[model samples]
Each structure stands twice: as structure tokens, then as C-alpha cells.
Target chain A: MNRTFGEKVFNVFNLLFFLVFSIILLIPILYILQQSVDVGAVKSGLSLWPSDPSTAYYKMVLGDQGIYGPLLNSIYITVVGTTLSVLINAAAAYPMSRRDYKPNKFLVYYIVIIPMLFSGGQIPTFLVLKELGLLNTLAVCFLPVLASGWNIVLIRNYYRSIPESLIEAAKIDGAGEFYIFGRIILPLSKPVIAAISLFTGVGLWNTFTPALMYNSDPTKYTFAVKLREMIVVQEDMSRQFEAMMQQMALSSASGQAMTNEGLSAAMMIISIIPIIIVYPFLQKHFASGLMVGSVKG
Target chain B: MERKLIGKKKGGRLGTTNIVLTLMVLPAVILLTIFHYLPLPGVAIAFAKYNIGGFQEWVGFENFQYIFKLNNFWRAFLNNWMYVALNYVFIFPSSIILAILFNEVRIRPYKKFVQTISTLPHFLSWAVVGGIWMLLLSPSNGYINQIIEALGGEPIYFFANNTTFPLLYTVIAIWKSVGYNSIIYLAALSGIGLELYEAAAIDGAGRWKQTLHITLPGLKPTILVMFVLSFASILNLFEPLYVLSNAMVRESSMVLDTYIFQSGIMQGRYDISTAMGLFKSTISLVLVLASNFLSKRLTEDGQSIL
Candidate 1:
């Protein structure tokens, strides 16, 4: 079809809007990267471009006695948590997807509605975790959120799309439920699994509230909690510095050594790197098919 | 006779196997039962005069009475409603628009680039976003204000001003979430049948008219589901406000989640906080059910949620 002049104008305007929006979106990320590299630039004042850039902050963040411990903690939780969650959710979803499974509808409703409608508030959940001796433990970070209703729903929806004839044929081969699930279902279910894994992985990696609520130990802090501490502590430190500067003008020392902006930017850049690495790999699953498949079912 | 005995044994084995299947799901079931279901009864603590390190003294409905009497709770409730309304009115629609615009771009590389840049903010913790926002919105030396001065306008201290804080919070929330939320809508848009658009075009419908009649309607189910879900969890907004809020905007910024967080965690007033939480949850539950009912009545397919 031939495009009209008005259509052409609209398309051009849309392109311009997208371009400007994209630039606006990227500025913060770029600013962070610049701050992370240019210590002197930040110390002097904020600069759009670093005159002399270095990897000193990167070295510090990655080295021992740095925030690397918490980074590793986040990674461990995300990996183990995503794997276990996907497995459990997939297993439960498989039987439920089968038409012949007894009490299927009720089970689906029970799993779906309970988490959505009702949740125990944080205090009692905390008390329960404490009673279970999960407090101050790394397991606490992943365990409570392991069986998500949304994930179960998503997996079940995906499983429903698989042809029933495939399962029926496997059953006719005298295969047990486990064999059909292992040999037939898991292989056919890779795309949905990948999608759910990415969703759960990002969720676990970025989760801070549970970490704060459950684990008070600094050593057990995930990357997210440490990032919060860094940002909040930096704000606190800057306020202190301001107060100190006000008092010090009446006293001897004229020079201040640290700036909060650089530290905060450094910490932000550090916290974001893991997500950046994982995000591109998972980006494909978030494209149209994943949701369409489930929604159609 | 031997074959019959073996078949009987196998039948018994299958019965035990089903029990094992049930057992396999036990860990999740047990954790959920304890952590999720157990705390429900504690919602009653909202009614009683809850005391820490003390015995079972039940002063019925006293906590609820106190909550109703408190001016701060009312203010917080109003503030929460404003925040939620702003989110729904602006941020939600903006996300759908962004998704449609994103879908219209045919250039593969440019689309990916835009998608990546836009979604980057969603990955940052609210603390980091707050920190960046603080720098950007700083009364002095803020990049945004600096640009405003360069353009010969007065610099605005957004976070410090109560009137602008809600708008600021809403914009930042949209900036962070629009990309992530749009992915779902984009997924919906992609599933739309191309033949419908072709059919519309053949009927002399323009792009705008086609979108009005076809694209928007095609996206209605997803839009409705998302809106209902967003409404259900409106009171759960905590991270952004908690991170961005300061003394300047404190009066306007206190929402249900932040209030609960402060009372329960910071002040160690567990009972009042739990009461407030129960109140919020009850409202959310009602909203979810009402929205689901509404959706079921309006749509032929019924609601996908619940």
C-alpha cells in the first residue's frame, strides 16, 4: 500500500518521539557509567564527560573486602532459587494440565486464588520464618518466594497448549506419569521454562525487602540490600559531611576528602552489571510469543 | 496365577506412587501453609489491644477505633489513593502508548536499542533510582535544573515541594516501569490478527480509525487484565515512595505501605501496623473480586485473571 503525506508525517513524528525518549532513558545509565569511571571529575563537581577515566572503582567493588560477597550471595540465590522454582512449578503444572487428572480444577483454583487473594502480613511470616530457624540464613531469601502463584499459572497455561495426543500416546506406551513428564513434557516445554526462569531469576536477583526482613546479618546481605545500604549510607554520610563542612569552616582543616555522588554512582553501576549481563540472554523470551501462548490457552 | 499376583502388587505400587506424587509437592505446600495461611489469623490482632511481651488481653475493636480516630491514617489513606489514581491515570496509559509506538517501529535494530534503553531502569533497585533522581532533581546542581537555567527558566525543587512530589513520583514510576509493563501489552499487540487490519484498510479505514476500531479493541483483554491486576495491588506500592520520600514531601508522601513499614518495622508498633495492613489487604481483596466480576460481566471470554 502507498503511504499518504499525513501518514508519512505521523510516522516521522513517531520516530522522533521514540528517539528523544530513548535518549532520555539512556542519560541516567550513561551518567552512572561516567561517574563510576571518573573519580576526579565527580570530586571537582559533576561532569557530563570524564576528562580522565579509570577502572579504580570497578577494582574496588570487585576486590575482596568489597561488595563482591553480597554480589555472589545474590547470584547464588538467583540460580538456585530459579532452578528449584521452575522445577516445582513445572511438576505441579504438568499433572494439572492433564484432562484426566483427578481433582484438577479444584487444585488449579486452590493454587491460583490463595496467593492472589490472601497473604499473611510480614510480621507473622517473619515469626514463622524465625520459628523455622530460617532467619539470618541465605535460604530465607529464596524459600519464601519459591512457590509463586503467577509462575504456577504461567506454567500451567503453557502446559495446556501442548497437544493432549502427545501425552496420550506416551501413556499408551505403558509409560508412567514420571516417564511422560520427563521424556515428553520437559523437552516440549523449553521456551516457557526459559521465560519463567528469566522472570524468576531477575526477581530473585533484585529482591531486597525479604533480604532486609529476614536476614539482619551484614555478612549474609544480598547485592540488593548492600546497594540500599550504600545509597542510604551515602546520603547519611553526605549530610554528615555538610554538617562537618559547616562546622569546619570555623576550624583548621579546609579540605574534604570524599564526595557521596561518586560513591553512589559507583555502587549503582556495580549493582546493575549482573542484571545487564543476564537481561540480554532473557530478552528474547519476553518477545511476543511467551505471553501470547499462555494467553491463548 | 503368578501374573495375577504380580498385577495386584503393581496396583498397590501405583497407589503408593500417588502418595509420593503428593509428597513431592509437600515442601511448597508446607511453606505456603505456614507462612501465607498462618498469619491470616493474626489479622485479628488488628481488632484487639495488641501488646508486646504481654498476655492475652483482648480489648475488642480498640485498635480499629484508634486507627479511625488518627488523623495521620486518614491523611495516609488519601495520599495512597492519590498515588494509586495517578499511577493508573497516567503511568498505565503511557505504558500502553509506549508499547504501541514501540511496535510501530519497523527497524529491527532501532527497536531493540529503544527496548533495551527503556527497560534498563526497571533493573535498578528503587534505592539506585532514588539516588539518580535526587541528583537529577537536586534544587541546585541538578542536571535537569541546570538545563532549565540554560533554557532561561526557574529551577524547580521537585522533591522538596509537596504539590509537585506526587507528580514527580508518578513520572519516575512511569519512567522505570513503562518499558517493563509494555512488554506484556506488546505481547498482546503482536498476537493481533493482521488480516483484521487488512480488512479494515480495504473498507477505507485510516490508521487512526483502524486503531480505534481494531487495535484498541484487540488489546482490550490484555489492557483490562493488566488494569485489574494493577488495581488489586495498588496499595502494595512501597519501594519507590519509601526511597524517594523526604521530610519536605513527607505529608503528601505517606502511603499505606510506607505507613505500615514505618509503624511495624521502624517504630516497633506491630499491632497498629498489622491492623493497617489488614485494612489494606481487605480493600485489595474486595477490589480484586469486584474487578473480576465486572470483567466477567463485560467480556464474552470472561476474565483471564482469577
Candidate 2:
């Protein structure tokens, strides 16, 4: 199709705007990457690119005393938590999605509206968790948010879009409710399920607030809390630079080399790596699922 | 035959098994009820003088009166409004425009690249994103200030200056969300029958004309739904502000959610925070209901979000 001069100009302008915007989104990440790789550059000053790249910082983060346990703890919680959440959410959503279910619509609406309108506040939630004997436990991280209102709605909406005739055909073949749900509904709802799994997994993987509130036990700390401690400690060290420098004249101190910029960058990269690996596979469904669930009534 | 029919009717009676459906939903129901619904009664604490022991005495309307009297609350309220308004004004439109532009991209690899880069920020937690932004907006060696200086402008401390808070907040919000938000528009755009665009092209319509006449109109329902959803989240603005804000810009940066987090959780003033939360929720609920009502009135096909 032929385009007008004005149209061509507008397209050019659009391209330019997007190019600039995309760079704005990526540059910060690149800067962080540069900092994380260069211990020498961080010590000297900030630089756009690393002058002397080394894997030493990454080695320190990975093999550092007191870091590996929290890392393992985070991985364990995220994997177990995400799997349990997906199962419960799917199980609950599948039943609600059944055409003949009498309370489906009401239940769906109830779940959706509750999160939007009300909340008991943090203290009450903390109190409830405390009373349940789940505080500081890994189960506390997963169970409270098992069946998210948003995920349920998303899965239900996806189930609604499935052809009713397909379910009817399965039912006529003497399939029981559980059999039909497991064999037919679950298989057909893969995209939505995959989408929700990614969403829930990312949320659980990055969860910090619950860990902060519930798990006071240093042993129970997730990667997020551990990362926070690392960042905070490094920040404190940065603030005490003059004092540390003065102390350096008196005596060479061990563990005084920890800098805010390097450790924070390393932690940031570590926190993001798992999600980054998982994200691309589910990228297509991520936006579409969210839009469908969020924008649709 | 009559006996068989009678037997079937007796057997088909709604049994105890039906209540299992409610039982299945009970966990979420109970959790939300305890955590979400239970907070409603505590709104009463807002009216009472709250102490470590809980509401010590009935101080009817005193908390509300005090909140209204406080300059901090007013400043925070205005700041919250400004933040939401800026988001609606800029990010909302930008997403729509980006979706349209993205749709126009016919090259397969370029489309994938754009989509991949755009959605990266959504995965990064607010804390991490805030750190990145902190560096980016740093006065000495930050990329943004460097660019400003290179362009013959003064280096601006974007974060420290209260005046730039709204703009910075809006830009970061858009950067984080625009890609994610545009996917709906992209989906809506794709759902539009190609015949309309083809027919428009046949009628000598240019790209801009075809977009105006075909694409925008096709997106009307999606746009309406997005607008309603965005309005619903107006009070839900907390994470970015919480992470990025510092004391210097606190007056302009403090939002309703952050305010509640500080006053309610940090200070242990449950009554006041509950009141603030309840107030925010009430307004959001009303707005949602009103919008849904209006949507139903205006469009026959639109589902009522309420």
C-alpha cells in the first residue's frame, strides 16, 4: 500500500521515540551489569563500562559464608510454593468453571471483589498467621496466598472460553467430574495454566514482605531477605567510608572491602536470573493472560 | 414408570455433597474473610483512641478530625492525586500509542525484540528497579544527568527535587507498565477483522486515516475496560513510591498506600491506618460501581465489573 509523506514522517517519529524509550529501559540494566562484573571499577568510581572485568564478585556472592543457605531456602520455597499454589488454584478454578456448578458465578465474584475492596491490614494478617502456628515456617510463605483471586478469575475466564460441547461430549462418554476435569479441562487450559504458573512463580520467587514479617529466624530467611541484608550492610559500609578509611590507617580490617555498589548489583543479578530464565518462555501468554483477566469483567 | 420417576426424583435431591463446593472454597473464603473482611470493624478504631491495648476509649470522629486537620495528610492526598492523574494522563495514552505502533511492525524479529525488551522491567522487583533508577538519576555520574549536561542543560537531581517527583514517578511507572498494558490493546487490535482495514485501504485511506477510522474504533471496548480497571487501581499505587521515595521528596512522593503503611504498620496506629485504608477502599469501590453502572448504561455488550 502507498503511504503519504505525513504518514512516513509519523512512522519515523514513532520509531525514534520507541528506540529512545527502549534504550532508557535497557541502559540501567546494562549499567548494573557493568558494575557487578568489575570490583576494581566500583572501588575507583562509577563507570559506564567495566574497565577490568572479573568473576571474583560473582564467586564471592555464590560462595560467600551465610549466603548459600538463604539462596537454597528461596529456591525450595519458590518451587514448592509455586507448585502447590498452581494445584490448589487449578483445582478450585476447575470446579468453579463447571457449567452445572450452582455457585460458580457467585464464588468467582466473591473472590474477585474481596481483594479489591477489603483487607484486615497487616497486623491482623500477622496475628492470624501467628495464631495458626505457621509463622516463620516455609508453609507460611505459600499457604496464605495459595488461591489468588486474580489467578482463579484468569483460569475461570479461560475455562469459560473452552467449547461447552467438548465437555458435554466427554460427560456423555461416562466420564466422572474428577476424570473429566483432569483429562479434559486441565489439558485444554494449558495456556492459561502456564500463564498463571509463571505469574505465581515470579511472585513467590521474589516475595520479601511475608518473609520480612513472618520469618524473624535468620535460618528461615529467603533469598530476598538475605539480599536485603547484603544491600543494607553494604550501604552502611558505604556510609562509613571515611571512618573505615581512617581505621585502615590504624589497622587493616577484614570484611571492610564490601562495597554497596558491587554487592547490590550482584544481588540484583542473582534475584533476577531465575525469573529472566523463565520469563521468555511464557512471555507471549503473560501479557495476553493479564489483559484478558484484568480488562474483562 | 411412575415408580421409576418417583425414585429418580428422590435420589436427585440436593445432598450434603453439594455443600462440598462451598467447603472447597472455604479456605480462600475464610482467609479473605479474616484478613480482608475482619478489617472493616477495625475502621471503628479510627474513631477511637488507639493504644497498645487496642481502642482505649471512644473518641468519636476525633481521628478523622485530626487527620483532616493535619497538613501531612492534605499534602499526601494532593500528591497521591497528582501521581494518579499523571499516570492516567501520560502512561495510559503512551501504552495505547505503543500498542498501535507495535501492531504496525510487520517484521517478525523486530516485533519480538521490542516485546522482549519492553516487558523486562515488569519482572524486576520494585526494589531492584528503584536501585537502577537511583543510579540512572544520580547527579554525578548518572546517565540521565550526563545526557542533560551534554545537551547544554544543567544536571538535575531528579529524585531529590520535590518538583520532579510526579514526573519521575510517572515516567518510571510508564516504563515499567506500558509494555504490559499494551498487550491488551494489541490483543484487541488483532481481534479486529482485517477486512475493515483492507476495505479502508481500498477506499484510498492512508495509514493514519485507516488507524483513525478502523483501529481506534475497534479498540473502543478494550479502551473502556482498561480505563475502568485503571480507575480501580488508582488507590493501589504503593510499590514504586515505597521503594523510590526518600525524605527530601516525601511531601510530594507520599501516596495513600505508603501513608497507610507508615501510619498504620510502622507506627502501630491501627485505628488511623484502618480508617485511611477503608477510606481509600470505599472511594475505589464507589468509583468502580459508578463506572460499571455507566458502562452498562452506555454499552449493551459491556460487562459490569462490579
Computed on alpha carbons, the lDDT of every model, listed in order, comes to: 0.75, 0.72
List residue ranges in candidate 1 displaced over 4 A: A42-47, A62-66, A243-258, A291-297, B1-17, B152-156, B300-305
For residues B57-123, could you state the per-residue lDDT of candidate 2 as single tens digits? 8887877777888787777778777876787789889889989998887767767787889877877
- With a 3 Å backbone cut-off (N, CA, C), the pairs that clash in candidate 1 are none
Which has the greatest lDDT? 1
What tens digits encode model 1's per-residue C-alpha lDDT throughout A72-160? 89989989998998888877777566554445676666666777788767655665676689888999998877876667777778888
* Per-residue lDDT of model 2, residues A1-112, tens digit only: 6877887888787777777878777878888887678655233343467766777678878777788788888888888987877777777776577545556677766777
Candidate with the greatest DockQ versus the true structure: 1
What lDDT is reached at residue B207 by model 1?
84
Candidate 1 versus the native: TM-score? 0.90
lDDT of 1 by residue, B44-151 (tens): 767665545532567677777888898889989999889878977898899889988787788898888888888768767776788788867665456677777778
Clashes of 1: 0
